[model samples]
Target: MVVGEFTQDVDVVVIGAGPGGYVAAIRAAQLGKKVVVVEKDEVGGVCLNRGCIPSKALISAAHHYEIMTHASNIGIQAEGISIDYGKVQEWKESVVKKLTDGVSSLFKGNKVERVKGEAIFVNEKEIRVVSGYEGSRYRFNHCIIATGSRPIELKPFPYGGRIISSTEALSLKEIPKTMMVIGGGYIGIELGQTYAKLGTKVTVIEGLDSILPGFEAEMSRLVTRNLKKLGVEVYTNAMAKEAKQTDHDITVTFTTRNNEEKQITADYVLVTVGRRPNTDEIGLDAINMKMTDKGLIEIDHQCKTSVPNVYAIGDIVPGPALAHKASYEGKVAAETIAGHPSAIDYKAIPAVVFSDPEIASVGLNETEAKEQGLKVITGKFPYAANGRSLSMNAGDAGFVKLVANQETGLLLGGQVVGPEASNLIAEIGLAIEMGATLEDIALTIHAHPTLGEMVMEAAEGALGQAIHQINRQIK
Candidate 1:
């Protein structure tokens, strides 16, 4: 030990001030533990600062602009509608500042000390946090790692000036006249569609057979149809070979599904393949921490790592790289550290894609149930048959689908593709979480002329008692 240096001791030290880390710090503090958070960048991490919040702001702006430009069909007229993208970005930044500031306020209220530095493990019991020329060590009784993950960079498409990642895509100074998107996962699709609605000529290249491969084919197809309506081009089973950037534009070359070569030019190319866990640089090898072959830290239900006192959550652990999921695990890890029997339950983790009309799902869909050898029954109700959807001009857009055990009528899962899908999926998530059955959802009377009624209607259809749509009689 240095003569002038002293090690700071805390009851809990959390790495990364993102959704997972900060939440863990607050929960631990609430449970009477001295907490310290080590963050390399901004306090809110990528989700609030660069990813989720900012992108959603832009998506909302684009959606409003699209609606205003085409309101004539709804017995209303909007004229001379234009978007000042500069103002849009400023407003988006304001929204981000408010949320990040709120998180910081919560930290201060909870008395969690935040250290702005990069944290590296010194051993199983201590860590060195370095900020520029200064460095400090923290000895913690327990540690929670919520380091999260980073966007995966592809070899063929190294990010630079014109080839940008989502982090850069969200902060662009000006909206491009044309944009090329690589990878058609949720991130790419969301951003691509946002720009498309904003009047940018957008092209999407997906390596798989379909975009949003994690979602149901029917649901994703609706998004694909909407993309075409927005004048966006989509290519599936396509490989992005290379990119050539000029001062004014970027030219991307790729091979089609049939092995034919093609090229497209755009102002910028956005890459959103996936995210990799931020586990490499934190010096996990020093503590001999266990991880998967893919570099994900191994954690049990309590988010406890192999070293009992050290824990990991969020993108570093096995599960979807979602902010809410990380936040949930953060609380569970904090409770477990406080000697509570808290554990993780992943049965009802809802995933939502904010594309045009949105797509949301929770638990097992029909295909998944059938693959697992469970006798399943499915019911679907189109948005067109719902009065609220018709009144809202979304009648031809999407539908609600429900999946359940045929024998027991227990709700297994639900998928929604339409307006307010993100909000509507929560009911299904709660249903699955509480072990609610089809009859439970159907028997609960939903208010008339509301999108929520579709849930009840879908449930009723599954039981052969649908009112708005034709029912399927169980033999």
Candidate 2:
């Protein structure tokens, strides 16, 4: 049968209804523009459907299980604690469904049209969306591309049989007895620790000298210590050579720091080295769009592509591939499309890793500041001294480190590694964005017996006026 051709016109058409794409669509609609979103699969994309939400859900469950099994010191004895992983996955899927359904409802409430299909560019102002046997063309005044990214699979360890990616790991029906993680980045470490807490023998092989090379060595050291406590083996300065799979298990060969080759066999192998942009199959060249050698789209501060009527955001653009960062870029792109003069400013974007003890950071660290030729003063406060951390049975968990200007006392950056580090990094991020100084945070009286007081204590320590701990004034 021959298909008929029809074209629909809209004010804006957003491709890939991920966090970035959906946010862009809703915001464009809210700004009085008729918007239509085209997605190949689910509305919430990978972050809601697979990556962020599901991973965090599993992590929370694993954390609870770990705490219950080891809380005898706190007068709570949980004998014979067992995990029903199938039910855990069911609960995880329920959480995902609620959020994705909420996104669908928002699209309806905002009157943003959603077309389910794979989209290809016909030109800057026109696109064709095909779903199964039917195809439709869309003509728009403006377009935003937010297709996001997928995990990178190494040639030696293609994803099949015993070899898996994060997506497959999250949806596993049964927990593996043993697992091997290929990389030691946030994704690998996060999932590795999650399974370890749930009673799996885990091994991590990192090409760099340390896991999470993006963070400070001190912060990474804290996570390494926690991983050891969980009985997880970590190999830094190691290179993965190959993977061979059998009917029963998979074996991975790698070279160690001493240039010795070693092998480990496990029920499954997870490769989470990094993510590659989803730019190749979208027909970007049809519109002559500009892209980097790394396959990232080149866009201005306003998220405008080389094509005047086209724009891009999120993981497709250069920066850390974070869901929050993508959502922020979406808003900026939509506001700019609405003629609101919004531009991207990433001075205070925070990055968080939900490890055993979480690690979060924003802006520059001491080494970065010094490399940039800025004289910096540093302040450090431990969770051991905080009343809240001590009461919470995590006194020796982690600490807060603050970096400030030596002469002006301006807060430049901060790093937190411990319980609730993910939530605690926000205050420091706000301070950096608001141009708050050391005195600004220290002078503000924080409530007593709270974890947040550590921020103030750190600031006071920088000023040589710390009351809870010995003050070492930065000369």
TM-scores for candidates 1 onward, in order: 0.98, 0.99
* Candidate 2, run of 10 with poorest lDDT: 1-10
lDDT of 1 by residue, 94-125 (tens): 99999999999999999999998889999999
Residue 109 accuracy (lDDT) in model 1: 99
Residue-by-residue lDDT tens digits, candidate 2, 176-219? 99999999999999999999999999999999999998899999
Whole-model lDDT, model 2 = 0.94
Model 2 alpha-carbon miss at residue 419, Å: 0.7
TM-score for candidate 1: 0.98
- Candidate 2 residue-wise lDDT at 184: 99
Shift of residue 267 alpha carbon in model 2, Å: 0.1
Clashes of each: 0, 0
Stretches of model 2 off by over 4 angstroms after superposition:
none
